[model samples]
Target: MSSPRRRADLFLDPADDPREGGPSLGDERATLTEFLRYQRLTLELKCSGLDAVALARRSVEPSTMSLLGLVRHMADVERGWFRRVMAGQDAPPYYRTDTDPDGDFDGAVPDPAVVADAWEVWRAECAFADRFVAGAPSLDVTGDDRGELTSLREVLVHMIEEYARHNGHADLLRERIDGRIGQ
Candidate 1:
């Protein structure tokens, strides 16, 4: 787990093309946000065109990693990082509680409503995170995390890393759910 912070470094310079991987050539804030968005989009792409069954299929036996579960978990993560930590709010866990921390992944059943709700929550959280970053003053802005101050730059980088890691799981789960592969 990492601390979240508020920062407004999402200014896209007029010269830098936002389409390209912002890491290659862009301002620090734009690059970080772009990369994070890319990873988030990758997760959505991997889950696209799938129904409840496909989304909820536990492709990896002995492990409960499913597309639906990933969406639910990411929704929780986004809410935890952005709403709770960054905004210093007491937002309750979206899917899990302290007693049942794995509820997000465990409760991912093959139901259309469950899938729909997970996607909706995930998208909403992502949008909220974007808006939070957009409204921040600077990447240097700090937030308190368990008594420790953390910078927005660190949170953004950690978010990108988190999505990339989960997207790897999504790749495997997607391939197992359907024969589709590549990118």
Candidate 2:
């Protein structure tokens, strides 16, 4: 009938899944955290074991997307929503600016230093976000998104959506690179 849904080559082992054992049946905050954590781990897994060149390899012509770009982009996203918006910090973007709107993707060169910096920033931002969420009194904590007062609940959901979408992209990108595939 149908060929196997998964390719026999390079799939992630179930035992290595980072999303395993999260509070799937927990309350809203726990659920959101679990989902976000899954997405974050998926991003990391997809990018694992690649050198700077592979990390910066473009997916296709006219598109600047790459695994390295995704890492940098997520760093900015975590910083933006969690620190700047939610915590009202004065932090600016890590990889974007007024002149370079796509700096995250565009600056993803095949340089080990760049890749290392991106990972460092992304991990730090994630840690900060985790702290903010844990210390938050409630998901109802309001943050100014542009001009509207948005709740932490909305931001968490949006972050999950963002990572989910990008992780899909990462899956495709990684597959294109080395035939790796999995959830």
Candidates' C-alpha lDDT: 0.83, 0.93
Predicted structure with the largest TM-score when compared to the true one: 2
Candidate 1: tens digits of C-alpha lDDT, residues 56-161: 9996568877989999999988898888888898878789988888999999999999998999999999999999998989998887777888888988998999
Distance from true location, Cα of 156 in model 1, Å: 0.5
Runs of candidate 1 exceeding 4 Å displacement: 1-24
Q: RMSDs, each prediction?
A: 10.8, 1.8
lDDT per residue as tens, model 2, 111-169? 99999999999999999999999999999999987788999999999999999999999
Which residue runs of candidate 2 sit more than 4 Å off their true CA positions? 1-8
Model 1, global lDDT = 0.83
Worst 10 residues of 1 by lDDT: 5-14
Residue 37 shift from truth in candidate 1, angstroms: 0.8
